[model samples]
Target: MLQDSFGRRFYYLRLSVTDVCNFRCSYCLPDGYQGKPDEAFLSASELEAAVRGFAQMGTQKIRLTGGEPGLRSDLPEIIYRLNRIDGINNIAVTTNGYKLPQRIQHWADAGLNHLNVSIDSLDSSTFHEITGHDRLAEVLEGLAKARELGLTVKVNAVLMKGVNDDLAAVLTWLKQTPVTLRFIEVMETSDQAVFFRQYHVRGDDIRQSLLSQGWQPVLRDVAAGPAQEFWHPDYAGRIGLIMPYSQDFCATCNRLRISSLGKLHLCLFAEQGIDIRPYLQTGVPTSELVQAVSEYVQGKKATHALQSHNSGAMANLSQIGG
Candidate 1:
């Protein structure tokens, strides 16, 4: 297993297939995705080789992320290849859900069993204002289809002050939808410090409200992310909170990240990503790739510095599919 100096063993890998996104969420890409066309993002073969290396080191869950992974035309093929890897038992994708209604079947057929979609608001007008896209109905339809196909679906909503923080409607929908809805705290990045300060909402307040309303905490699975899940007997769905600013949030860290350019990131706010693309090139031995990855994880830090408002090299969340 890949154990860091702090004794945290990693079993999950978040791999960014592309840095390009089509959505213009207020929190992430307020200015829109401004990047050169067809940048040198990871190819299907390169993604497979990277996963092979991680699997060799006991990584069992692989999450395909990006600015929006749905933008990748070969994403299904990438998922198919990762699913065939020996130690990888779970394959997931985190997307904006723009193309999910049309492409979900192909993804499901390609061995994807877990998915997390971004839906900022349940109100159409609010969703449009937050995401810069009028696709709330369309994305919700795709989510229904995903459930019908037996994939574990989760919805992520960023908790922002005076924005989509009102969760009454989302909770009402969850009573019937039977999917997990996770509310994420707006984190500070180097470039978005002002926005973060203005809109940040504390997740602990929401957790306290849920606890008072009879919601029961659920134990996390070994491969689960930072979301603290809760269930209520009156609702069919569960609630989760990703409080990155919470105290000791990284104590349970069990995942590493790889950027679209194949640089290893020990934490989302790490100072820099260590380039390991050379080891992932064609014909490189799996052992060589594994060695490069193991060495990087050995240097992983115990926690991030978001509490101090230091985002390090992470100017934007999309850089590593945060």
Candidate 2:
């Protein structure tokens, strides 16, 4: 087993398949940002090899993330390769949910068991305003398609103060589906911090807003990630709040992220990551790669200063595997 500076075990890996996205969400990629990477990101084979090496190091959970993972054509093949690894216990993907309806069944067949869809608002006009795209109805349709394919679905809503603070509308819309909804507090990722001050919503504020609407917390004793979970007494599914800004979960963060260009990020707010593509290209032994990953993990920070410091110059969420 590998451990970080904060005594957090490394078991989960978030892999970014590409840095290209169809939508330019306000919080993620602000409007009119034209900076795109040079090459077509990692090929399916390169990503598969990386996952295999990480899995050999006791990383059992693999989450495919991206500017939008569905934008990649060979995503299923990458998932299939990861699923075939010996130690991989779970294979999941975090998408904008724009293309899920057409590919949900294909993804399920490729061994993807769980999905987290980013849906900031329930209103179509509000969603279009937030995402810079008019695919709100398509996202809802994708959520339904995931459920139909028997995939465990989670809705990730980045809670902003005046943007989509309508918890009532969000909850009401979620009640109509079986997807578990999670409200994410905005973080201080590089480009995000530019607009962070205006849209920042603390996790405590989110909990209070929901409580005011008669939502009760449901406690569970289970392994943890970035989300602090709760449940609505009357709703069919649970509510989770991932408060990376207000309350840090670095002490229990078991995951590491890999950028689309094959860099390993120890923390979300970290400025730089160790490049592993050289090791991959050289056909290094698995043990050597594991040792490299161990060294990177050992350098993980105890906590992020997103609330107190400025991290607006760091890599965007699309480039750094959200």
Candidate 3:
């Protein structure tokens, strides 16, 4: 495994294969913004090469991300190819779940049994307000179908301050479904200062609400990523809180990011990344690719920049993958 300057070993990779998304989420992308042109997307062949290279260098798990990864017609092929790559133990996808009904079967056939769906709100009207679409029913349908297919599904939310922080309804959904649920604190994204100021909920508030319900904290595994997990005796699934803003988890960060356009981000809040597209497209030797990635990892900082100073490096979350 490649260890950074701070001794953080990077083992998980969030790979972006496309920048386009079907939804215009206010938090993820600006209003009325379109994705880059087709010429900018990563080719299937190039994506495959990069995955193999990452796996060889020590990436055991990969989560395919996008503005909405399901928008790509060839997503199944890409997943299947990665599943067959040696040293890659787990292959998953993070999506909005709008296209799950139409495209989920293909993904399952490709050996992708893990999925993370974005469920911003349980109220249909609140969902519409947050995501700019009345697709909460669709997301729920996708979750139900996922349970039926025996796929391990995890629903995530940004926990927007007063807009959709309804833990009661969310807890009810958890009781009904066999899927795990996680709530992430809003991060400092580029260009969404007003939204953060108006809607950013603190980590302490979310915890207090959950504790008030008498949920018991559960011990999380070392490889559990950034979430602090919890459980209730009555629910079939678990609850996780990822507090990026309230408390940082950079000391134990074990992930790397590869943007669809070919940039390798050492940290999510980084100002820039190394473009590996040139090496991937040129049929470079595995040794050469591995060496380049190693050198880049050595330069990885101890932690990402502060959100307050991140305004200068602010970028659309979609650009670096979710």
Candidate 4:
């Protein structure tokens, strides 16, 4: 198995199929945002090859991410290919869930078992203001379809102070759904500074607010992925907090991000990533590529500066395939 310098086993890999997205979320692409780069995005076959290479090196968990992964027409085929790999234990996707209702069954048939969708607010107007679109109803319908298809569903909410900081309202709305709700703290990225100034809520504050509203924490161990999970005493589902800014969890971070343009990022806060596209284009053997990946893994910092002063710059969460 591939191991990092800290002896952390490298098993999870997030692959970006494209950087182009349909929605312009305030935190991700904000208003007046320019379009994507002219660089050619990796085709579905190329993505499959890279995933297979990682799988051969003992990577077990693979997640497909994009600015909006569902925008890709061949997404089901890509999922099918990745699922056929022998070493992959889990195949998941992080999507905006705009097209989920139409594609949920196809994705499930393609062997995608885990799905995490981005939904910032339950209010229709607030949703449009945040996402620059009016597809909130469609996303909710998709969630229901996903549940019907037997795929594990998780809702990812980026908690901003005044935007959707009504923890009580959000909790009450989510209590009626079976999907796990994850509240994510906003991080400093290049997209829009308005969100940084307008609504920067902390995870602890969110938890405290929930408790104040009579939500008792049901004791439980942390979940396996990046999210720190908590269950409500009488609630049907659980709540997760991913505090990358206020409380970073880089120590337990075993995942790496591979950009659509073939750059390998060791950490989410990393300013630059080592580009392995040239080597892949050279027809290098899988072992050689694995060795290069190991070198990159060894370079992971023990912690990120989001906890302290911001010591580094990170790509936009959408660009980095959150």
Per TM-score, the best of the predicted structures is 1
Better of 1 and 3 by TM-score: 1
Query: What TM-score fits each model?
Result: 0.99, 0.92, 0.94, 0.91
Model 4, span 1-322: residue lDDT tens: 7778887776788998878787878777775235564558877767777777888777888889987788788999999998998888789999988878999899999999999988999888999999998999999999888888888888899988778877676667667777788998888765545557677787888777666767665443222567766766567677888877644467677678898888998877776778877656536676677778877778787777765436255546767687
Per-residue accuracy of model 1 over 170-261 as CA lDDT, tens digit each: 88998888999999999999778999989999999999999999999999888899999999999999999999988999999999999998
- Residue 60 displacement in candidate 3 (angstroms): 0.9
Distance from true location, Cα of 158 in model 1, Å = 0.5
The CA lDDT at 210 in model 3 is 76
Q: Candidate 2: lDDT of 18?
A: 79
- The number of clashing residue pairs in model 1 is 0
Question: For residue 244, what is the lDDT in candidate 3?
Answer: 68
Name model 4 segments beyond 4 Å from true.
209-223, 246-248, 279-283, 307-315
What TM-score number comes out for model 3?
0.94
Which residue pairs of candidate 3 clash? none
- Residue 199, candidate 1: Cα error in Å is 0.7
Residues 1-322 of candidate 2: C-alpha lDDT, one tens digit per residue:
7777667777888888877877888887876445575565778878878888887877888899887888787888888988999988789999988767898888999999889998888888998998988988888888888888888888888888888877777667657665678888777666665677788878888778778878776563222357766666577777888887655556668888888888888877777777888666546777777888888788777887676765633656677666
Hey, what RMSD does candidate 3 come out at? Answer: 1.7
Worst 10 residues of 3 by lDDT: 305-314
* lDDT (CA) per prediction: 0.92, 0.78, 0.79, 0.79
